[model samples]
Target: MHPIIKIESLSKKYKDAELYSLNDFSLNINEGQIFGLLGPNGAGKTTLISMLCGLVKPTSGHFTIQELNYANHASKIKKIIGVVPQEYALYPTLTARENLHYFGSMYGLKGSHLKDKVVETLDLLGLLKFADKRIETFSGGMKRRVNLIAGILHNPKVLFLDEPTVGVDVQSKNAIIDYLKFLNQNGTTIIYTSHHLAEAEDFCTQIAIVDQGKIYAQGTPSSLIASTAEARNLEEVFISLTGKNLRDAI
Candidate 1:
């Protein structure tokens, strides 16, 4: 099977920045795998995702999504990728249903077909009862679920999620993970970034530990944990590789 996403000698440097956020990174993410990009804050995880999603241009290097080069086939690539941003991409003034309607319409979905999909996904994520309520009235978990539904209405082949469970309760996190697993099982390739090592260990089929804009270690969770001498879990392995230093950038 061909890799769903391929990054070749990828690097990026923002204007006025002292160093490159990503430095000569290269990786191949296989189709249908739950790939986790585990890193601390400012590890260039978001930068990499943004480039892959076509939201930002790389200063150098190139990538292919679904075997199509990003530079030439961006339009075709966009149709097959769903991006669930770290921030809530919902209208606080609108009801959940209304918000979903807008998101669905962006992908050219309309009428009863879009409405039915929105309702079904909302129901699946336990937000059906709250669909008619304004987003401002919803909890973080509810908003996260709704945000997820927004990205997936079009059923893209690849999904890019940034910290999908950052500030939610354990129950909500489980619900999100379960739904992601459901999508992955049905052939959606998932790439996500998060600080939740335990969750990533259980949720991801492949993992890459990134630091200082580079991949320090990468493999399956079990393989990563086993590879480190005296490492008990993903957290131990992470700390052992990344260290205890604080990355404070002005």
Candidate 2:
């Protein structure tokens, strides 16, 4: 299968940073696969995803999403990719339905089509009853689910999420994962970064372990688990590669 996203010699250095945020990174994500980016804090995972999403420009190198390079085809690329950042992207004053309607409009969806989609997704995520509630009144899990729906309402070919399940309850996490699985099953490729290893172990088809701005390892979760001597799970593999260092750099 062809990769939906390709990275080549990707590197990034912030203006005042002493070291590159990403160093010579390269990766390929196959279509329909859930690719996990696992790393310690300050390990460059977010920087890598930010570059791919065009939220941050790389200092050097390039990436292609569905054969379209950001340098020349960014507009085209944007049309087919969805992004869910760590922070909530909804307006606190708006109702859930209203918030989604605004987001869908940003993607050119409108009228009955957008309305139906918003209603359907809300119903699917078990939020139909709360559609008229202001976002400020919702729980963390509720906001997270709505945030996910905002990115996916356009039905993009690829989706990128950062710490998507953070600060959410178990039921909400399961709901988010189930919804993501539904999208992946229907042909959306997922690329995400998170410190949640046990969740990634079950959720990701492929995993990349990055540390100090480089990919230290990449493979299927089982392959990665078996490759290490006595490494039992994703967490063990992570610890083996990233060590116990406290990445407290400011």
Strongest candidate by lDDT: 2
True-structure lDDT of candidate 2: 0.94
Model 1 TM-score, all chains together: 0.98
Residues 11-79 of candidate 1: C-alpha lDDT, one tens digit per residue:
999999999999999999999999999988889998999999888899988889888976688789888
Best by TM-score: 2
After the best TM-score superposition of candidate 2, give how far the Cα of residue 109 lies from its true spot, in angstroms. Answer: 0.5
Please give the clash total of every predicted structure, in order.
Answer: 0, 0
TM-scores of all models? 0.98, 0.98
Candidate 2 C-alpha error for residue 128, in Å: 0.7
